[model samples]
Target: MTSNTEVFPVLETKRLVLREITKKDANSILDYLSDAEVMKYYGLDPFNSLDNALDEIAWYQSIYSNKTGIRWGITLKEQGVVIGSCGFHNTVSQHSRTEIGFELSKGQWGKGIAAEAVEAIINYGFKHMHLQRIEALIEPPNLSSQRLVEKIGFVREGLLRNYEFTRGKFDDLYMYSLLKQDLDKINSM
Candidate 1:
């Protein structure tokens, strides 16, 4: 587990590099954040300008500095450009838990990139961070995200009705969770 004292960790999988988000990534951030299809389920509307992406990178940095969370740019090794982002949205150290969030460029959809990035983070969370659990929240309409979580071993934990207001309306969400114990079991196999 990374402590507040440690610098942001960079994680890597077979085809992706998960590194700390930076202002340099603003253009890449816009590659997905500005897309209607990509931002459809996100809490905010699609970014309309480069400044929005810059602000987003700053926000991500602030959370990392505040020790509240950390996000990584999901860069494909072959492309050498970030196609998405993923990381802990909240790290409740007291509970040894964190909530995971992720998004990818629509152009990269159906390529299993999300799954690879997420699995690397989950492994890092459990093995390095000593985290006990990882949680995910997804809008009910996002079947692909639901499938991604389930494929990563998250257990459906029911719904939170009108859990969040996003894109001008209250949206229902489903909660899913994965425990370290379960991960251990899977790994031992």
Candidate 2:
């Protein structure tokens, strides 16, 4: 397995580039993170200022430095502007597991951009991070997110009632996972 401290991986797909997010991207980050509809199921309130976006970017850096997780900004190859972000967090290296999260601008929805970016990261998690399982926790009401993971080959394990407290209340999340073997099976077929 590769060390998490190594250089951040820049992933690519046919139409997207998954690269590290820097402070300069704060404005683009805020563009989506501050939207109430986009933040609805994200477990955090909409960002109120550019400072909040900067802080969020800092958290992404801290997780990488701490060897806990990684997040990548999603950009189009043609535009090179960040439209979204995705990555694994709450990583437990010893257990070979981690959780996945992602968000995109409302205007970019239904374009299959997120799925492309997420698939690249999932492959990286298994091959580079040596993770056995990558999980996605989706709020029950977030059917779109649930469908996204399912379309990516994740199996819904169950629901974790009140699994997290955010936005001033406890929320139930559905546990969805894609094991490394599952990916192998999909690829081999």
Clash totals in order = 2, 0
State the lDDT of candidate 1 residue by residue for 1-189, as single tens digits: 233577788887889999877777888898789899999888988998899998988878877877777888899886668899988868898999999999999989999999889888889889987899899999888999999888778999999999888778888889999999889643542
Instruction: Write model 2 residue lDDT over 61-168, tens digit each, in one string.
Output: 988888899999999998889999999999999999999999999999999998888989989999999999999999988988988888889999999998899989
Give the clashing pairs for model 2: none
Top lDDT hit: 2
Lowest summed lDDT across 10 adjacent residues in model 1 is found at: 1-10
What value does the lDDT take at residue 177 in candidate 1?
A: 94
Best model per TM-score? 2
Model 2 alpha-carbon drift over 4 Å, by segment: 1-5, 185-189
For each candidate in the order shown, give its overall lDDT on alpha carbons.
0.86, 0.91
Which residue pairs of candidate 1 clash? 1-128, 1-129
Each model's RMSD to truth, in Å? 2.6, 2.6
